[model samples]
Each structure stands twice: as structure tokens, then as C-alpha cells.
Target chain A: MSLDASQFEAFSASELAFLAEDELITILPRQNLSRMDFKGWVQPALRALRRSEVPLWLAVILKRQDRCTIIYPNWLDATYLKTVLEAEGRDSASFAALPYMWQELSDTILAEAAEDCQGSVAEIMRTLQELKELRLNKLRQGVLVNNDSHLRMDGIGSAELNLVKPILSKTMRTLQTVKDAQEVETV
Target chain B: MNLDLESIINSVGRRGTRTRAEYTTAPAQRLKQWWVAERMAPHLLEYQLDLLNEVITNCRSLRDYIEETSLTLLDEAAVESLGEETLRDVKIKLLLVETELERAKFVARAYKRTRMAKIDLLPYYYLQQQESQSGIMSKDEWVYCHHRTELEASSYYKGFLNAFPTELQGLTDEDGHISMIETPDMDKPVVVRVNTDIGTLKIGSEEVELVKNGVYLLRFSAVSDYLEFVDIL
Candidate 1:
């Protein structure tokens, strides 16, 4: 099989992370460098001790080389995550408006650049786990009760959405066809 | 069944991009759109001939530049004379290009291989489609599809097809009865998001109100015409 078997399915975990790496983030440089063109987009030149916005992939490379420190986004802070966790509980009908790639971005930062972050990593992880559970629970409930042809997925994070894709698509299609058949018989 | 179907049926579908974020679709953005749609779609989609050409050309030149610079740096005479700062700069630039090149290569290879998998599954079915609709396969892909069917036909004849009765030896459906060629199951369910408000779309016996940014689960055939506004997830 010359083909990558992973392509047959929805975005895999690594592939989603690859896509998330394209979302721009701030990183503080330890050395200065001139602007470089990436063909798709251009990254501005960096100066020592200066904060620069670059795609997360570049930041990861720079960080790996001991040339830069990635600045943790505000949403990943323990305080901010607590608030969003509360928001998740308070609103069962919709997802908290997190960045579309919030799960992947936060996970990557914590895994690769945890030392530069300000607070407790365990606390952040716990909060994220709870948030994931709450939303996934809600999604499960939504699927069971939806009965409609469409699933309301606005504000759902990319990781969470992809998690339920295969099952949700199959379940909803079966429900839809059976519902349509029943409706026709009733008429 | 009504006005929407008649007008949109002949219109080709272009996957919707995020107008809210960037109105201009960059090369990367176009590649993302085509890659996702081709993977998620059960059948082969309109081949992205132009986008692949642009990206492949860019990658080829970048690969050449990387090779040229790395070779230059490898020469001890040249590296021994350069200042530390310049050497470090060249190395960092090389690393950046190498990393970015891997990503671009992934997208290009993955996109093409995704289509090839579908083509190899049932080459003759797509070859049949080339007569009615030609845009689905690129010229190279068309040749590949042609060769696969040709190879298969010859292998069939060489093995057991030569010994079979003359009337039963034909591989294709000629009597308009049982279908010897398999086509994609368009009725297969697909998960799609409606990026634009296209009002109510009739799916089966239900009329789905595709509000802006609303996601829907629909049969591939029902929403085939409106894919310009809908994205297969």
C-alpha cells in the first residue's frame, strides 16, 4: 500500500496537531535573526529578548534549539481555565468559545514547553481533563436527544469534534433515514 | 426536487473557505481545503491540478536551495573561513527550511496519495466517468487510471478469461442489467458543515435548515451540488 493508511480516516491526532501548529503564537527569542519567507507566509525578523509572533511549529523548532521560549497563551493559565471550566458547566447547550485548536495547542505547549510556563502543570492538566469530560458528556447527551437531521457543533473544539466524527456520522445517518421512512409511512 | 436543485445541479462545487478569518485563500489554505475534502469524500473529487503544480514547483526549488547551501557549508575550506555568527545563521536557516519543507511535502504527498487510493480501488469506473465528466482526474491521473484497467483486462484474459465461454468473457456490463463496474456509493452518509446560509435543504423527507456555520449530517448525493457552501468533515 503506497498510500498512507491514515488518510482513509478523519484527521489523526498527530495530523490535527500539525494543523494546530500553524496557528500563530508568541515566543521570546534568545538570539536575533532576520526575516525569513516560508513560501506560504513570512515570519518577521526576531531580536534578542524581544517577543515575536510566529507559527507554533517554528516556535517549537526554536525552543528545541535553546534559542527561544514559548509564551503560554492566556487561556492555558490555571485561573483562566477555571473560569472556562465554570463556563462549561454553566452552559450545557453550547461549548465555551475556546480557540478552535485549543486542545491541541494547549497540549503541545504543556508537553513541549512546560518549563517556561508560570503555574502548576498538574493543575492545568486536571482542569483540562474536567473540561473535556464535561463537553464530551454534553455531546453524548446532544446526540441521544438530537433526533434531528443535523448536529449542532458550533464552538466545538477540533479535537473533540474529530473524536465523535465516525460514530456521530454513522448514528445520525441511520436515525435520519429511519426517521424519514417512518414519516413517509405515517403520511 | 424544486428551484434550488435545478439551478445548482450543473454548478460545480468549490469547498468554502473561512471568509471570517481571511478573504484571500493562500496556497496553504487551498491545499488544506482540497486535502480535507478529498480525504473525507467517499469518491474522487475534482483533482487540484493547479494548486499541486504551484506547491510542487515551490518545494522543488526549495529542495534545490537546501541541497546547494548544505553542500557549500559541508566544504571545510568555506566553513573554516566564515565567522561564528554567519555559520550559526546559515545553520538555523537550514533547519527552518528543512522543517517547513517536511510539512509542505506531507501535504502534497498526502493529497495526491489520497486520490490515488480511490483511483486504484476501481479504476474502470472513473475511466467510464471521463467520457461524461473529465475534470475529476488530472491528465497524469487519467493515464494512471487507463493503465490500471488495461493491466487488469490483460491479466484477466491471460489467467482464466481466455478459457471462459466467448459470451461470458466480457468484463464490463453490456446488457444494461447487472452492473459489472462498481461506482461509489453516493448515498453514504457524510458529516458536513454548512458555512453559508442556504436556507432549507430537503434531505430525504426532512427539510434541513442550513443556517450559517451550522453543521449537518447528510447523504453525499443530497448535498453534492451545494458543496461550495458545505465542507465535508
Candidate 2:
């Protein structure tokens, strides 16, 4: 996820985090505050003990300041992730569905607001690690059988896709060039 | 509220194949899409002048708001000296405003840098072939490209190109089958996420079912025509 000179086409880890910060998350405010105009959209005023929706970045800031606690998104729940992990194990050919920015979002929650999460933090982390490894293994296997003209990447999340981006694009281009040369030879 | 840029950009909803008309009016999302598209596309896309203007206006308004509020805070401190809770509220509001402004500024910088990277590639080619991108180069972009092209051509000439035959001194020659001009590789493979059901689209010798949200690796030329429905990953 680190940016290098040759990897300009894709987003870096920090850039991905910046993009994911826009994702909305529900938070419970600890104090009453007036609505904030976030330039584009207005964040509703926070009332003590009441749940309100705010972008993940704002939620993280407030959480750090002890003004709010973040409610975990449904997909990030431990029980839900357990099922997703099992599904990835169930299918070796395809990946299970996850949000596009799941990697960055989950990392932020775990790092900044673990106390506000509903489930055991360690268990969620363990499940997430397992899911990451299993999907990566499946992708490695998929590469063994990748064809020249096109490849199907059905359920690869943005983070996972980004990690394999350089190799994936290079391999596809090389295979394409070779195939085109062979066709020219045949003609 | 998932708020993924994809859903937000496509949320205006399509009545059929007219997705182009539904480009989201949300300034942030528009700027984001422009940035991402510029990064992803094989060729230079149209200059998003309207979107850039909107972002500039928004940034100015935010700066004014921040400055005015800060003065008010200072005045209150000088005269009344706000109590504990009131001061905290004001500080938090100010903090949020500054952070959002920084985020917008980051987007603005990142967007310009992304285009600059592309513009630096074959600047003279794009200058001569403006029609290829529908002449979407902004005035500043034009000046930059022209200056870069001149600098690059002059350096080459000084270093070595001056010694070549007079006929061979010409660059950007499209006379032969193998043109001297540099162009983006349209046939290059790119990853694309289908925003809508584009049905069956052909890729090389293969046909792919581009179902909504399905990802595939295909040539840029094939996906370029469906920019409204396909997001290059």
C-alpha cells in the first residue's frame, strides 16, 4: 500500500484512508453541540445520549476527544465477519463480498475507537486476519490459471485489489503483448 | 449511509442509458470522481473546469468563515472571556471547520498533481492533438504543457537532436506506420468496476457479462466508451 515512483496509477495506504474517511458511521454523543457545516453536507447537532450519523473522520475526531463513541458498522461486527470468513473458506474460486474500503475503515475503528465497538476487539481482529489470509491465498491460486485476454476479479475489494495491482496489470499486459505477437506471427 | 464514492456518484439514478446527465452536483463527490478518473484513465480526460471553479468557491467561503469565526472568538476572549463549556464548544466547531478545510485542500492538491503527472507525459503530443481530448486543456494547463514541451524539446536539441539530419529533426511525425509522437496505450489492460449492468461487452476474443458492480480486467479501449457505467479500478 506504500506509494513508490513506479506505482503512481494506484492509491497509497494513506490516500485510501483519506477516501474512506467519507464513509458514514453512527455515533453517540456525550455532549450537546450545534450542527456543523462540513462544507458540502451539514452534520446534525449532537445531543447527549442520542445516536447521530456522521462521517467516519469526524466520528474519529470526536471519539478521540471523548465527545462520542462509534457504533460499529454491521459488516464489521464479529458475528457477521465470522460468517464472511466461513464463506471465503467455502469457496476457493471467488472472494466473499465486503465494502470497497473495508480495510481502511476497520483499521481506523480498531485503532481509534476500539472501546466503543460492540464485540471483543481481539476476536474481531483475529477473524479479520484469517479473512485476509484466506482471500490472498485464493487470489494467488487464481493467478496460476489466469488467461491472456482477460481476467475476472469479481469480489476483490479496493484494498486487496490495490495490493496486487502492479503484478496484476503487468502480467495482464505482458500476456496481452505476447498473444498479440503470436497472432501477428500466425497471420 | 455507505457513502462510497461510487454509490454517491451514481445515486442520481439513470432513466436508461443517460447516466452522463446525472453527474452528481455534490461538489466534493464531483471533485473526487474527477481525481479518481484522471488517475485511472489511459488518456487525458476532459478538464473539469466547472468542478474546479465550484471547489475554489467552496474553499474561499470556508476560509472566510474560519477567519470571521476566529475573530469573534478572539473578541469574546478579550471582552467577556468565555466560560469553560462555551469555550470548548467554540473550539470544537473551529477544529471541525479547519479539519474539513484541510481535507478539501488535500483533495485539490492531489487532483492537480495527478493531472500534472499525465500532462508531463508527451506534452507536445497533447498540445498538437488537442482534438483527441476535445480540446479540454485549461489555460494554465496549456501554458504548463507548452513550457514543458519547449523545455524538453530544447534540452533534447541541445543534447543530441541538433546533430541529426535536417529532415530527421522533426518530432511528432505521424508519416510512417510507426509514428515518432508518444501516445497513451489505449489497448493497455485496466481494472474496471461496472457501475451499472452494461450487459455483454467484448474484450479481445472474449465476451464478458458486465453485471452491476462486477470487476474485470480488460483493455482500456473496450471500457473507455462506457465511462458513464464503468469505473476504472
Candidate 3:
């Protein structure tokens, strides 16, 4: 059966999961957290997915269409996206999900400090404080997530965690966008 | 490569611009005129064969890629980056191949038109003309004659009427009369009027009532004859 535009409005997570399993396509948002003003980005981004007339294979598997709105609408837009990526020293090709953005931020600002200022209580305090603040700000703005969102990060080792900790603690919400795309394809 | 501005300017001035009308006959028709029908047919056949081959090759490659890759090895993320690129490439190739197919169809149409123009269409016309010059006389002894006083004398009454050539067999006399013969016995002349191509003809004694109108053939008879001509009375 052909999908009607109206059918997109009330799809549930279970229905989406079933679709993912059967058709190997998923178009639902991976995370629906309502922190800060994130809903403003989420609604429009999800709306774009409803408007797309992509094939079933594309619609189900590359669930990127829906998750992109929540985590990366600004990046999707041509000019602002370029500015944001450029600020973090990332180009179009290297810009993956939000974690990549955080890595860029950490490498540029915090990575060297974590190593050089070890054992200094004052420096340690400052580093922890800084990372906490970043996380809190993202949480408030609904731009990213911290450990509060209840998402498990499996398959990542300790070294990878250390590398991702700064960004993931605050900006991991964007990973939902990637998960959403994967779920669509799996179905 | 060398500095020669003055010479270049003189050369430009020597040549003048010419203008002509825009519309020209299509390339396919021009091809038919240049190459005979037999040669054009083979070229058209070859073009269709080549188009089919290209489409088949493209489909095979796409099918191979789909069959060989697994969802895990080439997961959604990997496909996301490359799928759009592949679709775009295929779209361009399809459009180029379809243009050749359209050109071949145009050439085939031109060949058909050229072949039809080489047939003959004029046997029945001459038969009708012969009937008019010598009107048909009935088996009975009757003659058809027309009396003309000096005041009514006209060029039509003054000369021997000409016979129509074989190509115009359907020709008729001015009065819708065809040919005439001597009455079975010596009797008043009877005029035989026939409806044929254009004007009718009067024959034998021109005394019969002149029919200004043409006669219509019966549908079944006309179909059987198939060579009759129609004209305004």
C-alpha cells in the first residue's frame, strides 16, 4: 500500500520498530527528549521527513530524515552549518553526528589540559567544572544530552569513552539522529 | 601566439555576416533523401539493438551490487553516503541512451513516407474520358441531334470534339454525355450522357435534353468499379 502523508502524524515507536524489523527502514526520531527549546528544532525537522517522498527502502532504513531535525537542522541548512563546522575546525566531509562536533571542541580546547594538568586539584576541579557546565547548558537548551537521558553507550571501550566523555556527557543527544537512521534501515 | 592585433582587425573586417531563415527540414528526412530505404532500415535496427545492450549492462551492475552486499557489512550509514550518488549517475546515463532511441524512431518514420510516394494512381480517369467522347447509343433505332440557329451557334457546336488521353479515362463531355454510335436502324440520333471527371460531353445527334448535373454511381457498383471520379455538375 502507498503511504499517505496523513499517516505520518501518529506513528508509534512500536509501529516504527516493527517497520524497521520487517522492511529494514525506520524514520522515527531516536530520542524524543524535551529539554530546553529542542522541540522547536524537532518539530520542523520531523516535518521535513513527513514531506519527503523517498522510496520505502530509503524511508525505512535511512531514518536520518527524522532524527536530523532534532539534532542537526542548523547543520542541514547550507550556510549556518558551514559556519558551525568551520568554527569547530571540521569540514563538510568530516562532519558526522554531534559527537564529532564535540570531539572537535574538546581537541581544540580541553584535551591537552586533561593530560597536562593532572593531579592538580585546582586544575582537576576546573576541568570537571567546565565539562559539567557544558553538559548542563546543553541539557537546558535541549541541544544535547548528558548521562541523564538514560541511553546506554555500548560497544565503546574505556579509551573511546575517555575520548568521548566531554562531548557525550553534554552533546550525546545528537547520536539519536544516527540511531534513528540505522533503525530505519534495519527494518 | 604572437602580437598581431592590426592584422587580426583587418581580417575580421574582411569577413561579413550573412543571415538566413531559421526553419529547416528535419535531419531524419534529410537522411532518407541521402540514403535509400534499404540502407536506412539496417541503421535503425542497429541503433535499437545498441540501446537495449546499454540498458541491460546498467541493470546487471545494479543487481550485482544489491545481491553481494549485506545489511551489516554495508549498513545504513554507509549506504546513506553513497546511494544518492549512484542514483544520480544512473539517471544521466538513461537520458543519453533514450535520446538515441528517439532519433532512430524519427528516421524510421521518414523511411515509410519515402516508400509510399513511389506508387501509381491514375487508371480509372482515362476510362471515363473515353466514354464521354463517344457516347453510348441504345440498341433501339433512335438518334440524338441538337438543332442550332445562327443566333445560338457556339464554338462547341462548330468543331469535332477531342478525345481524352488514356490517363484521363474518367473524362466526361460538357452536357454529361458520353459516347454515341449509329442507331440500330436509321432513326433520330440519341445522345448518351455519362457523369465522369469534370465537365460532360455530348455525342451523336445533339438533340437530346442537355443534363447540366452529374449522376452519382450506386454505392455497391462504385465500390466494385473503384475507378469512378466525382466532380461538381
Candidate 4:
């Protein structure tokens, strides 16, 4: 049947990776293989250059094994990330849209091929962390000021939800108490 | 207890005509069939176990929802003039759902019981096989086996520990005193900066002066109770 956002959010990384969009990656094949076989994804024909568009999880595995090199995304550029960070500082809610599997893919790439990449992995990681913090701060502010009982946020993964759930719950409790006190005073 | 090689081969044969004919052709063929089945059983069983757990969880939720809806309908029928035929139809649907729920619950429990029995006997089987095969166990295999046992035991202990609250699950130190159970409160001490002119605040037995715009660290549990007054940092 039908599934809700929360249910889909609880899916494991592997399951989510299956549904993730394919990214164009340049992989240097270690062997002269005719094809690449990753479970749950289509087997792509290996070219002479060994570069192919593949899912994020498969790309990470291939990169980890040193079977291929994944070309970094343009947004992962140090200059672009720095600009984004500045923008976030000015308006946290106005940050640019991220890829559906941006968090998982970036984490995998940094973990597997941090040293091998052209740009420093630490810088990329720092930018990602800063963006996450900015979004979380925006969420906290909204919770405190907004009177609505239900808070709807899209594009938040299970990992991010877990990080903010405790604080959000606490904020809701405080809001409820304030509402109760006001009602009693009026009565 | 005896390794019924013939019976194992016969069972595997029943699944395919080719295998059935092959089993009776030669002793080597019979042995091969038995070997294949033995190798595949555990892997197949593992997949089946996972599928069973998923089915069980889904069925439990469905059953609970149906039960709740049935109660609500019954209450409405009592207050309003719902038709007798419609009420009877609802009751029949509820009965069928209850039956299916019971069947699902029974199947889940039976599978779990059988799996637990097999797990409980595995160590004994390994010990006996080790004794008979004497010194054949590789160092890596020995370590792997012991690690699995340790993991199983620790998981059971963890389930036991969950019965106690975080503040009571501390281990006793060398001085025979229970150590403070570290929780989120201890890990992330709640610090607040007082904006308004507040008087002295007593937390537990200690009293601290609250000055305007003064920052102070307070116990998370204590402050959480009155979180409306303070701004959490």
C-alpha cells in the first residue's frame, strides 16, 4: 500500500541508495572488465575509459576498492562551498537545494577517497557540517516562534531527524506549557 | 542424532525429478545431494527468519488498528441508530480479521521458538564436533566462534539492562559503590544565560544566584522540568 514520509525515512542507507538518482562519475577501471555488476542496480557496460553513470552507493564501493575514480561534483568545489556558507550565515533558510543523497554520497566519498581527490576532504566535510548546523538552527528558531502543533519539513533524512528530535520534542513541551499558562490566566 | 544421509538426499530429491533420479543412480550422487542441502539450509533459513519478522511486525500493527476501529464503530452504534444488518456485517469482518491476526501471531511465535531452540543447541554441537575433529579448528575460526557467542550473550544482557532506567544501570566500582550512570544529562550539561533579573535558584541542595544576563550551568533533568522559564543553550 501507501507509505508515509516517516516510514520511508526509516529505510536503511542501502535501501535508500537503490532509489537514489544516478550521478555521472569518471571511474578508472583497474581491470579491462566488460561490465560492472552491483546488486539492485543495472549492470552498466564498462567503456575503455571505465567511466560510467552509476548510483552513489555503487560509486562509493568502486572507489573504495580503487576500481575507479569518482569525479567530484561542481558544488563540492571549495570556492562554491565557501560562498554557500556565507549565504547561510546571512539567511539560513535560503540555502541552495542539495541532492537527495547528498549527505550519504559525500560521507562515503570523504571516507573512501579523501586523500585521492583533487580538493581536500576536510574542507568539504566542514562545509557540509556548517550547512547542517545552519538548517538545524533555523528549525529550532521556527519551533520556538511558530505556534502550529504540526511542523512539516521536507528533504530531512532519518539521520538528521534523529539528531534534532530530542530538541524539537523539548521545544514542543515548552510551547504547550506556555499555552496552558495563558489559558489559565484568561480563565 | 544420527546423520541420516539417505533421508537428507531423499528430501532434496522430492523438489526436482532430476535430483530424485540422480539420488538413486550412485552412492556418490546421494552424498552430493546431501552435501548441497546441508550447505544451503542455514542461508535459506536466515532469509526466511528475516522475512518472518517483517511479516509479524506488519500484522501486529494492522491487527491493532482494526481492533481500535472496531471499538469506535461499536461505540457509535450504541449511541446512534445503526442498522442491525450493518452492525452484523461489521462484526463478521472483525471476526475474520481477528482470526487472521491470531494465525499470523501463532506462525511468528512458532518460527521464533524453533529458531531459538536451534541457536541454544549450536554451541553444544560446535563443542562436540570440535572434540571429535581435534585440533582441526583454525585460530581464526576459533576466534570467530567465540566472538559470535560473546555477541549473543551481550545482546541478552543488554535486553536485561533495558528493564532498569538509565540512572540505575551503573556498575559498581572497586570501592563497592555504584557509579553514576552516565546519561544525556551528564554528557550534555544544560547551560542557560539568564536574561531577566531572577533571584537565587535552588537545584537539589545547592543555591546559585541568578543575575541579569549571567550564564550558568544547571542539571539538565532539573532544568528540563521548568524549561518554559529558561532558554536552553
Best by DockQ: 2
How well is each residue in B1-233 modelled by candidate 3, as lDDT tens digits?
23245323422332111000100122332232222312211111112223333334444443444344434234667656657745433333233223323433444443333222211111122223225643221111011112111212334333322343534332222333553221111111111112344342222212222233322211111112222232110
* Candidate 2: docking tier: acceptable
- As for candidate 2, its clashing pairs are none
lDDT of 4 by residue, B67-170 (tens): 67577686975625657755544554455345435544544544444333333335434434446774423343345545666676568568786687765553
Candidate 1: stretches off by over 4 Å? A2-7, A145-148, A176-187, B1-26, B162-164
Tens-place lDDT per residue, model 1, A21-111, is 8777777788989877666555656777665666788889899989998888888899899999999899888888788888999989998
Q: Rate the local accuracy (lDDT) of all candidates.
A: 0.78, 0.77, 0.28, 0.47
Tens digits of lDDT, candidate 2, B205-225: 778788898888777888888
The candidate, 2 or 3, that scores higher on DockQ is 2
Calculate each model's fnat, 2 decimals.
0.42, 0.42, 0.00, 0.00
Q: Candidate 2: lDDT of A35?
A: 70
**Worst 10-residue stretch by lDDT in candidate 3 chain B?**
B15-24
- Tell me the lDDT of model 3 at A138: 37
Residue-wise lDDT of candidate 4 within A1-187, one digit each (tens)?
2223232113345533432323334444443333321111123443334334444544565555555666676677667877866876786443345553566666666676676678777777888898777766765564342431323333343345445544554554465567657878999
Residues A1-187, model 2: lDDT tens digits: 1123454557778778888887767677799998766566566567776666667888888998899978788899889999999998998888888988888889998999989878899999999999888888887776542666677888787788888877777788888888889889999
Q: Write the per-residue lDDT of candidate 1 for residues B24-133, one digit (tens) a residue.
A: 25465578778888887778888778888877876877798799889989999999888889899889989998887888888888888888898987787899898899
**Model 3 residue A87 lDDT score:** 39
